[model samples]
Target: MSPQPQAAVGAPLSRVDGRLKVTGQAHYAADHAPEGVVHAVIVDSGVGRGRITGIDTRAALAQPGVLTVISHLNAPKLPYLDNPGGYFNPQGQKLRAFQDDQVHFRGQPVAVVVATTLEVAQHAANLVKVDYDTQQGSTDMTDAPSFELMNYARGDAEAALSSAPVHSDRSYTAARTHHNAMELHAAVAQWNGNQLTIWDKTQWVLGAVAELATVFGITPESVRVLSPFVGGAFGNSLRVWPHTVIAALAAKMTNRPVKLVLTRKQLYTNVGYRPRYEHRVRLGSDRRGRLTAMAHELKAETSRYETYAEAILDLGQMLYATPNVSQSYQSVALDVNTPTPMRGPGYSSAAYAVESALDELAHELGIDPIELRLRNEPQEDPAHNLPFSTRRLRDALRTGAREFGWHRRNPKPRSTRDGDWLIGTGMAVGCYPTHRQPAQARVRLDADGTALVQSATSDMGPGTYTSMTQVAADALGLTMRQVTFQLGDSAMPPAPPQGGSITMASVGSAVQAGCDTLRQQAIKLAVDDERSPLYGADPDKVVVRAGRLSVQGDPGRGETYRRLLTRNKRTNLEVLGGWSPPSGADRFSMYAYSAIFAEVAVDARLGLVRVRRMLGVYDTGRIISPKLADSQALGGMVGGIGMALLEHGEFDNRDGRLVNANLADYLVPVNADIPEIRAIYIDGEDREADPLGVKGLGEVVLVGVAPAIANAVFHATGRRVRDLPITAEALL
Candidate 1:
């Protein structure tokens, strides 16, 4: 049997790094101040699709403190390496910043102005001018030309749909959304001989190292990436974008350390975004609400150079017990930058469509939404025909419903009213596929009883540092103050990207393994030494607690690890622990599930929708830190509210440019927009999943929220809004 997870694994503790974060001692990429480091500002193209016709940098060079204005006209052509695995780039566009005059999208970096000061660089960048030969570009997913459709089919969906007793066909649209993290993307590049040292804001340091090495024609080992602290990522920093490469190129060209910070405007155009999606779903069910057939067709926008596809229909095939299921996903190539995965990516879009359709069907059949969902629950994954590793979705739904007082909800639209507001409640199921990756961690125990754990994974404001420290402390039998967790450096033990909610499961296991090894080593030393009280005791009978080794059933006979190390004349003991997924673990159904309930009050006269309360019950295997997990779940729900009622990236189809590029125009949920939120985790385990028994809670928490709120809005006003950002205009 696996050993128990000690200390804070299930404890409701605050973030271990909370003090450092609040005190402003955490070091972010832009916070570093290296000696002789210059500043750089990118000059972006104004035209959406164009080729440069002229360049004039005389005025930019004439400015004081200006070093050089580098553009495609003078920049050297570098090697464009082949695509490496795991970095999701559909375009396969090799790192080619400032390599050509051709522009594929608006705000594409045209040139970079370097100067002694950030102010000088900014001023010089505006002084540079360029002429463009513009061409009409399409940004609208509906208007853009599409390619061959990708299809998945199980049985005869058309026949089943036509023969079913009840059927519903609906269309839904999800608008483009930006990451909009609090910290803007920045990169600091320095070259010592042929080796490159970069302090960059990124989700995957190994991916960044490979990308930079390939771009500069250098070995991967020659590049060092550091991002010890990140304000927030939300999948924006998952890849090293062109801006990072441009900074490195600029630094190498001028032979000086350079810092480049992307402006908020540049963030929308350069970094990846959640692509807009249009889905048409047809559902067929019997009078008993058993799903008979499901057909889903999806179209989304991608860059002209890339064919990006979001698995918007993957869940429909497995979520219910539908025998006839057919899905087709297609993409329209547009003159825009390639889109990447956002939080919940395809699953969020899928949930919005499928859950909203279910709500509609429930209303049509005069059936309770929860009852309808329960009637169609599958014992196994219908698509894969495999038993689940561990599925507690029914428990989650029941618990959430009871907590939300769902039995008292009035199903009839506009039937429940309070004063001038129409009140209603709704719920939806959330699911995210569980993913695992191999990871490594190192633990060093010093003679003074202090321990340090190191990994390449990053925190990104999710309390990764704190959680790992807790895991290390518990495994090593040390206090929290005795352990320090270090991450966000490529030099540390390698780890997978911190996104996908896999960091804690992968890295925490490694920390556990490392600490266990350290403890066992100390035990072996204590039992073998003739001078120790446990000299004759069997190593297996010795247990370490509070950094002290003692024989089993004898608490009084123990020696401190510090004393043991001092007697051995050793300064410290170090161990490296590696963790990979259990063999054959992927052969079964694996996913994290959540049931979300929302209460809403819609102003009938003003056509305004306001959320009043939200409750989320999750079946994430084990709670690592109850307080941190609660925060993650609540934060995800807030983000979902924004996706449902406020957030949308408006694009000007005439030029394919994002119209609301800045914060003032683009909307996100503020503190005033959030409602009272609560989170509950089903106390459970999936021992086969991992040593930590943890499934990701981050992405799944937000998956069902938008649809739940949308369903509630319909219940409040008798309005079925299929599109996202269900605004007052939609109600009106």
Candidate 2:
């Protein structure tokens, strides 16, 4: 076994690209200013659901520098691509901007106005007129049609509820939320004869290439997609949205390179969002505070063209040891755009409801919330009946409680007050299962002793570039400056989507494999060369340190890699490393756990709630880069604060249009909103989980935070607010 180096792996090192980012040199997708680029502005339908009766582009075409206006009337037909197994949805009316006359929702692209300048394109887009045959559309989930329940069950929930000594039931609602990444979505498309190149803001560049290939009826090899820097992407960039396709089509139609950047209003209608959700939870507990039964019912909004469902009850069955658990989830189809996965996705929504309900149960039974959680910790995953790779929920809870001074918390609500504010502290446990995916990478060793690694994963602001480089550096016995990590090009080795908190576990393993292979080759060369000092050393007994090969017992009698390569007249060496999980590994239980603590202050008069401090203790195994891991932990906590008090996407129920489409109307946490946040990782490793023994940490940090804040509110005001964004209005 290789000994873990304490210096590089766990040390707090700043981002390797910090200089590039601060100097305005980091090139994002939109920063690629290609030559001969023309501006394209999409004209959207004003009506929610309608058919185009007439389009008058005569006035728009007469303007100077106005090249063409492509509408459904003049747009060419495209192949209606098939979506396999819900992985990618390419059909379903296909947003064919300038290809179809029917409008399913408001802000549906109807025409493209091409001009020499962006202002001309904007002016021409307004000049193009269209008449619509409008019809009524449903936008409100409360009023939309409901379907039969989708059910999951283990034991008899009703019977267990009937026999329980105590029970409580409550309903909670979460408003829709937009991703609201700082950089808006933009696409630059250029077409040459039979090939197309696109620079777009997307999480999955390969998925975008495949979608564009099918839409254009061309080979996948003919398309190249590049996105190096992303301002932020909760989950909005996971898939290729309609606007990207529209821009590619517009470029082909005009025979000119086209650039399309969505306005803030356009972002609301075009990009993906978290759908509104309503949950009803019923909990039954014994007098001693052990949960006996749980039943959850959930309903969320989806688009009429696509059915979307968030597994909001997934946590209830797995997080606890309840035997009688039952859940039903359904979606109501409305005339709205499809919703995609957001940060924490199903888990966050489920945690808010389940954790809040548990708090209520604790209050009813006169039990501390932490004590109640500790009482129900399970040895195995109850839902899957498989043993966990590693579970530290109890340890996390205990450590967090001690560090948070949880024992000092008053059991009675409104009992602790500080002058004009009600001060309270609360805690909750967070869990996110590990998702495994196969990945590949290429490692190259130059004659100068420097190394280069290539993969197809995007950084998306989690320091994927720096962390992967660090792993390669340690594996290859080289310093950080000697290794260069390359990614964000589809032409590189394939990889899984960067979401799901699985990037490090998947991509880092590939990097390690590649560097390990390169090191082994260097060792073999040293052992085989007659001129080398380590010529007679056993290859198996050899190890690399500081770019040198030597026998395990003698570090002084070693040959440098550069000297060996120069003696052999070798310019460079290369290898490809691939990793896929072994069979039956998926059958076993797996997950990462976290304990979160939050301190909050509530105004007794105005009903205002403010978080004063936060702490998260995580059990993510084998953090590759300590500084980057801490940043991820703190950033996730801030996002949770936004989910709890600021972020909400509002839509006009009358016309099925997003009402709060712009940032000014929609709310998100600013720098002033975040409090003093801190994080601690329980140092450990799970060799059974992966080669690197790392479970993902990106998504789980946001899971339990909202519930902790809501529980703190209950501790402060003696009020149980079930809804999200627990505003002053709700408390009053």
Candidate 3:
């Protein structure tokens, strides 16, 4: 077994790549300038749903510096093969780029103009005229045709609601939101014979390799995707999108290295966004706020050609102690790009409804909000009848409350006023299901006492590079600077996709295992060697610290790794470690939880709300790096503020077109909008969750944030808004 980490894992360390980034030495996807590189600009479909009638590319081809124009009308046929299993979509055909005349969604790539320069390509793309047979399509989640993909029931929820002493029926709607990552979606494709190398912006390099291989009818090994750095992903980069396919296709047709970049408008549709959601929650509780039942009817938007589902209703069934619980999850077809997972996915949308509804019930019963929640806290997962790996929800609540001065909050709405502002405090529970996946890593130790660890994972702004390095440094008994961590390459060790907060728990475990293997190898060699100072020492009693092997309590009698390896004629020591989550029906329900408290000031006459202070206490498993975890927590809260007050992806119902496709129109919280914020984590680990004993943290941080703000707004105004982005229009 590997010894506990001491020097690095738990320490507050800066990112190893921070200097490279600050010095402008980091190369992103678009920064790669391949030899003989050309540019390809995509022509997007203007209609929401249509059939391509005719495409005119002659004008584009005649433009100066225009290399070629490829469209469905003149493009070569691709394999357009179906994925073996769930490489991309488990069900239904994926969107094939420039492979057919049918336009399935708005902003779908219609044509590509390759040119010697980006300006020429842009001008050529504008010149390529496309005619479409427009069709009326559905984009509304509430009224679209729905298919029930999931249904569950434990008892009679309707009867419980009918007989309960207090009941609240409410509906909450969240507008569609886009993942506005700082780095634009881009791909630089280069091919030598059959070997393809791509520098792309993506969350999963292997996923991109697989999808690109399937599209070109090539082996996965022939495609290599590299993404060493990502500005941000949220969740939009989890899968390969159509523009990457177009870049490859254009590169092949033009017989040159091609760089393709999506415009800001194109990103809204080329990649996926958080689907619009309509969640109807009905809750029944006794007069004391103890639960009776809950029924969650969820409707979410998906492309007409694909099915997208999430855990929107799961929290309703398990978040509270309810005897009778039922859930129905429905997918509504829309004439839009396939919906992708955003920051919190379904959990964020569901918590907004469930937690806010609970607040409404509290107001109806004239009970304290926190007291009402405590009255129904479950001893175990009520829906699954299983013990939890670890649940520190009550402690998180109390800690957050005490720190935020919740006990001093004036319970009466509008009672605490600061001149023109009405002060209120509110809190809600946040959670994300604990997730783990199979992963592998390679650790190599050089004779120079430095270590290198590689895994095919992503950082995506959650400080993955920094966190993984910390784990490897401690596991290998080296200082932070002595170890280098590398990731975001398909050729590296296989890892699970970098979404759902799985990288730290999965890849981190694989890294720890790899380092442990290397450490054990060194220890065995040192003890077995006659020249070693600690010869014939008990392998178990020998500990390697700072690359020096010493017997416990006898550091004086030890040998340096440099001496051992030099005497042993070894240049490098390398080991591979793999981590596959245990197989079996889970007997313990696993999740990370948080109790977030917020204080908001609402302008009395103007109806504008501003967050005064926010604090979150988390039941997350042992935090890997306090600094990175703080960044994650703070970023999540900021995103939640956007979801609650400013962000909304409006659509024109008549044309099924996104109204606020650009960032200028879509408002996000600026520095002025955010006030004092803080985070706390309960100290401990979930041994059952993974080898690293960490439950996922990134997603859970965003859950329930919108509802917490909305609930606080209610406390200030004594009015409830069922929809998201509690705007001044709704508040007034």
Candidate 4:
């Protein structure tokens, strides 16, 4: 059959659920309240590492409206079955709440207080006291022992670095940061015999269902998870935290529905956060700015009980062309919570070190930064030994340079000034691999000329609801108003976990396939009907528009789907379709690309750095929704600014406690701090990547932002600060 008309695919449309969200009608996880609901408050350990000795719950039990105060000493022992679907922890076991008396880290949940009222729960939680036998522990990654996580080598990098004409070596450090989204993590769980239902703040409903079932030693089919709306997650909500399991356990023990919400301060300890990292980059280049050899050594913090690692060495191996390259990544186990993927994951951290080192190399060779990057563009992926599906770094660089007026930049640092402010401009390139997994979606078209598409995926503020609707409308030959998309329920068709920028490629493709199948089924029925206007027409030449089936280039020969279905006594048409990526090695290396540019002004006397303007040019393939893409790009740039000059997770190593645990002490960019920002997309699509031709967009937008701002800071001031959140003291 002929391709569906591309009417709504690239349209700049508003969010479909905008009215509900603006009017406060949309309910988040914390907003849910099941019947007979009771409140639960978790009491955490004060010591970093120790064993519980004694508990005093008499005062808490005497309080009015208090249901019970249960700790490891009084709580029933759970099965604690092995969870194969749990979050990625390659080395150690995940944390199990109330399973034992051993305390692994500070802020570990020790006991819980359940009460008829939330106020009573809070007061009773403080009344219950626990004593522990404290032991010394290390929380600082710089002082902890390191274990080798991964290593890679292509050639003799040491020999090549020794003989190179010019060399650059530098060390860069990034402070740990938290997601701190507007919504707090919450869960409301209810149990009926063996069946369990939970409303929780999570990125993956099916993953949570699987995890909860394993922890309680129940069948997966007995669990149902629902999370219809999420304020924002970034990456913290991808896993099932200990508190979620605690809520379920509490409901089972109390025989009443339980509601648990993490306070703002509790968020710092309960959920996962990005870990602090230290990187050493060594580069060897020729006088002409071509790279000869490169080596990277990295160390990051992780919980002593669970190992956490990311693709921190990917950029060093693939971003540039080098004959010899070597990399080693290590995790320094600390007395802290396990780190999780935040925002851009590994690429964002890697960019700061790799791009900053490249800028230094550009200065040493007396070559333009963009020009030097252009000189070493690899013809193929050196690590994968395959051609790129669509590598548009060159196009992104040239487009950003022209739009940002790169010709006006002065090569000398601190050469341009406006009154007391020193002005400078810098640019960097970023890349993220395209990831796709198995996904299935269901589509049903009613005789009333409306459609409903559903999947088990989620929308964590990336406009998944709007984008999927667009794809479905186009595929089904219907208008935007005639289609509705539903998500964030485990009862729907199975879908991959929503993270890693894979939702669009995997879930979207499934929607497209299902809609296309149902539309064609309607057309086939019409063409076969003897009484229809489209009777005897070739099915290959049929096209649909506004619920009407017509022959190609013949508007008069058509029939409305409502009339055809009503006449045939059909209620509705339905189909279930899925999309799966091929197994084995891919034929081509696929990745999204970005070229980011930033301009900053620095006050020499006060040591204040202000971003004046920013621009990001992206080649992330087809634009499903232009307006939402801009929102993602601009938000990422703002986050990058925080990484460069505002955000930091300070730790008091004496007890492995986060000093700035609250938002009041922790800093983020506000309206007064952000400047004019813009996003541009290069025109193209990558058919080799996915059926939708979209290489994921969310993660790549944030990958190179920090390095771009950091490089601009170096140009504005003569001094180079290797650490993140460039402070006034460092500048002075």
The deviation in Å at residue 522 for candidate 2 is 0.9
Model 4: per-residue Cα lDDT over 128-194, one tens digit each: 8899999987888777889888899998999989999999889999999999999999999999999
Clashes of each: 0, 0, 0, 0
CA deviation > 4 Å runs, candidate 2:
1-7, 87-96
Cα lDDT tens digits for candidate 1, 212-305 = 8888899999999999999898888988888899889988999999999999999999898988888899999999889999999888888876
Top model number, lDDT: 4
CA deviation > 4 Å runs, candidate 3: 1-5, 83-90
Pairwise TM-score winner, candidates 3 and 4: 4
Better of 3 and 4 by lDDT: 4
Work out the TM-score per prediction: 0.98, 0.97, 0.98, 0.99
Tens digits of lDDT, candidate 3, 1-732:
435447877777788888988898988999998989999999999888889999988899999999998888778888886644342453577888888888887788998999999999999999999998998877776567888988889889999999999998988898888889889999999988998899999999998998899899899999999999998989988888888888888888888999999999888889988888888889998888898999888888888877777767778878888999888988888888887888877788888888998988888999988888888888889878988999988888888888989888778887888999888888899788898999999999988888899999988888888999889988888888888999999999999889988999999999999998898899899989888888898887877788777888787988877788888889989999888888999879999998878888888889899999898888889899999999999999999999988998888877778888898999889899999999999999998989888998899999978988988988888778888888887877
Question: What are the per-residue Cα lDDT tens digits for candidate 2 across 244-356?
Answer: 88778878988888898888898888877888889899999899988899999888887777666655677888999898999988888888788888888888888888998
Indicate which candidate wins on TM-score.
4
lDDT of 1 at 274: 89
Ranking by lDDT: 4, 1, 3, 2
Q: Name the TM-score of candidate 2.
A: 0.97
